[model samples]
Target chain A: MTTVFKRPESLKDTETHYCSGCGHGIVHRLIAEVVDELGIRERVVGIAPVGCAVLAYEYFNFDVSEAAHGRAPAVATGMKRARPDLIVFAYQGDGDLAAIGMAEIIHAANRGEHITVFFVNNAVYGMTGGQMAPTTMLGQKTETTPRGRNALGEGAPIRVAELLAQFDGVKFVERCTVSKPRNVLKARAAVKTALSLQIEGKGFGFVEILSPCPTYWGLQPRVAMRMIEERMEEIFPLGRIKEPAAEG
Target chain B: MAEKHLMCGNEALSEAAVAAGCRCYFGYPITPQNEVTAYMSRRMPEVGGQFVQSESELAAINMVFGAAVVGARAITTSSSPGISLMQEGISYIAANELPAVIVNVMRGGPGLGNIGPSQADYFQATRGGGHGDYRTIVLTPASVQEIVDHVILAFDLADRYRNPVLILIDGVLGQMVEPVEIAPPPAADLPAKDWALTGCKGRPPNKSRSLILGENELLEMNRRLQEKYRAIEAAEARHEAVDAADAEILLVAYGSPARTCRSVVRKYRERGYRIGLFRPVTAWPFPSAALAECAKGASAVLVVEMSAGQLVEDVRLTLGPAANVLLLGKPGGEVIQAGELEAEIDRIIGLHKMKRR
Candidate 1:
């Protein structure tokens, strides 16, 4: 028997510390694969956000920088501007991007900085132990919203992809889920698309991956998939919301 | 042969930057210094360089940080209020030990000061405006030509020391137009950056950053930085002392206000007042030796500034209590007239003569 799939060279051989069945590991592998496929592994610089992915530098073989919480876009902007030839990306979680870094990410896209952004939307804060997130789904139960997220009390879940799609500076914007094997493949394509946009010298490209935190979601791998498939997709429909127009 | 051209102080700085091999500029629009950005915007594209108008002062400075990380010849200009917004990125640049030039065509300020020539930011520029135990080499350019030469020198010194250099001009110098000879362009063999993050492909992943986590590591980094600062002090301290050989009185000044004092020096020299002028070129390392030398046998030292005698304290530190130091300043939006400065000079001379008699 032979395995057709192997980890990308961009990813380190070290084991991930994420919970078993966590989608972060899957998304990380996808990003690494994209970086390798695009041949940008050596020229790629990754910015790790202040989240569970804080130690993302340890996992990626490429150059990595740690940014203050919610300031990854600002850091990425600096990295990209300083070395325009290098491929830079930010790996951020919902709590990091939507909660604290909303302004930074929005402004980065609005400014149309030529870089890629990989946003992981897991509905709840994973590193801080299942607290409420800006993207936490309504009626979803969490440590902070124990009786379910009350819309009137906690406000509504933020749709980052939708918000960023409105900005003219954003060259590419897409949302995909990693709840199942099919959607995982879709996410890989999305990641590739975003990276290719940057490679083509197009402005800001973003891919929002709806991921799952099994331990925090208090569900098994299969049950989490059901949650993502049934509920997450309803909240965040998949497909490209913005794409660069063909120059005639 | 060196070429001469007529230009404003801001245009001279921009032309000199191009000649000095600068290829990138990221800045925001601010008053009294819009000319710097406008000049760059017109010249950069023609030379295949980058000129970006960043969204805010915060974004512009960070862009400078980005460009500096990769060893691109980059700079940004802003007025006093914008400079305040750039303190964080400036601190980051210093902490990382990246080489870049920053032009602060300063205006009056503690907050939102008008777009006029003022030395209020003397303390902020000289004593590390940002929150960090670090220092930036600040150059005060009084004339349009100095602004041009200093901007080019700033890039060289920044790269030489791998530290940020601030070209501290003021509204008067920035807005003033005069005859300036554009320096010849640097040779094509300008220094190349090996530490930049330009694709990390040829190198073994060069990591140029400022994050030191452990206490011991942080302390060691600080010590190393202090050593670098000392080396910079020894290597790049610059000042100008005029007609101090047989002078009885010395006038200490810097920036645009120093230009006013230069005129006063000429007038007093005609009236038989032997007053010399000491202009600090590098405001950070200052010109302590030059100031000390100028005050050697002088009976009195006068500090003329547009601020509330900020540089006076620095002069006092250099001259000690032996010299009778007096501050002649016109703070709060009033320009220091040459006649006012001359009167103060005469009064000081009259008082010293009375003391002797």
Candidate 2:
């Protein structure tokens, strides 16, 4: 008998608390698979952010620390710097990464901390009843943006991958989506590359996953995925934003 | 390593932390405490330790939290405003039961107050500062030599209890320069942290978190935390009672103000006033039992602090109407003067004498 598909050993076999049609479960499995593929599960230390995935520690079958809101990058730096032998990564949402934690992310990148960052960009604050997030599209409607987000009043969406790539300390920065199976595979590859860079002792590697939040986006699960491919992809172009510096 | 050399309060404290096996220091530059950050940047590399001048105090404390999560001895130093910025992380660390050292060389504050020394943060430090029912072990060191000794003790206490230990000082102690005797590391070994998140290699995974959504579960956690605090209160209250027995006037104080009160005790006792000084070292586990016992025979108990009147509340609560509690609290970054305290003591004595007649 052949068992081709099963859960990754790095992911705990249990039910998660994520909402129906959310993209967090897919990304969590992708990370677990990536951890198993690299054989770094034993050495990996993950940091969970204060968001919908705050219970990531329960899903991740590895050591994990829960960080205060927007402080996961700094926490990751501490873990990595204390024991460089450990592979450390921070799983953050847009509210945790691009907004309140802007300084921590930018400075961690600027400092060239040998760690990985998995930034999930869902455009709206999912856990907090769909408030307008820093990455929310200019005209997107949210709880706070009742009429629609206005460029003059609220500010445009942030391109985190592009912003982080400008720093010399960052070794790799990529923006990918999990809108479709093909896009999911690409995002998986990007996650693997980011983790591999950390194993190789290359400094900061960041992957911005343009994830779907159907409940917050006020769309059906299938429609949310389609919208990510349509409107979200148009604003946040998916591809490798920055490549690792070439080896000599 | 001179046996006895002059050292600044900030640098000596930094040096003592490294000697106490602290290898990771994350801090932001702030007034009256910048010397601590400056000293760490220069000393850390030499000792093969890590030093990070974090982007903000928030990042610095979180870095400390991160380092401590992995069983690393980590510390972060800041002043009043910087410490305020760090409250969020501090609350998390305290609740998570992680071991870390926090040094607050406090300056005057209500909001961006001034770059002068004050102990107005007594309530903030003693009452857990941030929004929570957690408590931090606050150590008040009155001198450079004491700072050296207490910083070392702070690390051990933090690790032993699996909680954060705060070294509370102001500009007076943090900036003072004096001869200090830096001691060798203690003979006792640090307790093994079986719960540290050093990776789940060949073991069950360890998760460090404080989020408990279950109503009953959170109540149980809070009950367990209260039990731990009760154990700490029983085991760790420390105080120094100088010439307190058989005295009519007992002076209670901490930090540099305690020094002024000590001087007042010495000078006034010679002039026929039976004055004494009680200094609380561990301010959170605030030597309350010893204080209540010491205040029994005294005609009056006076609390001298650099704050306006925070410590007086505790003294009054401790004594109730059984004793007369007076406060000589001076705010605005100024140290309480010995002369002023002495005059207040004379007036209290005069009032008592008239009441007896």
For model 1 chain A, the run of ten residues with the poorest summed lDDT: A63-72
Clashing pairs in 2: none
Docking class of 1: acceptable
As a TM-score, model 2 comes out at: 0.98
lDDT of candidate 2 over A30-98, digit per residue (tens): 999999999998889999999999999999999999999999999998888788899999999999999
True-structure lDDT of candidate 2: 0.92
Segments of candidate 2 deviating more than 4 angstroms: B354-357
Q: Pick by lDDT: which candidate is best?
A: 2
| Candidate 1, B132-156: lDDT as tens digits | 8999999998899888888888888
Q: How many clashes show up per model?
A: 2, 0
Residues A1-248 of candidate 1: C-alpha lDDT, one tens digit per residue: 89899888888899987888888899899999988888998888887777888778778877776665676787678677656788888889998899877877888899898989999998999998999999999989999999999999799999999999999999888999888788899899999998988888888999999888888899998898789888998988888899765654
**TM-score on B-chain, cand. 1:** 0.95
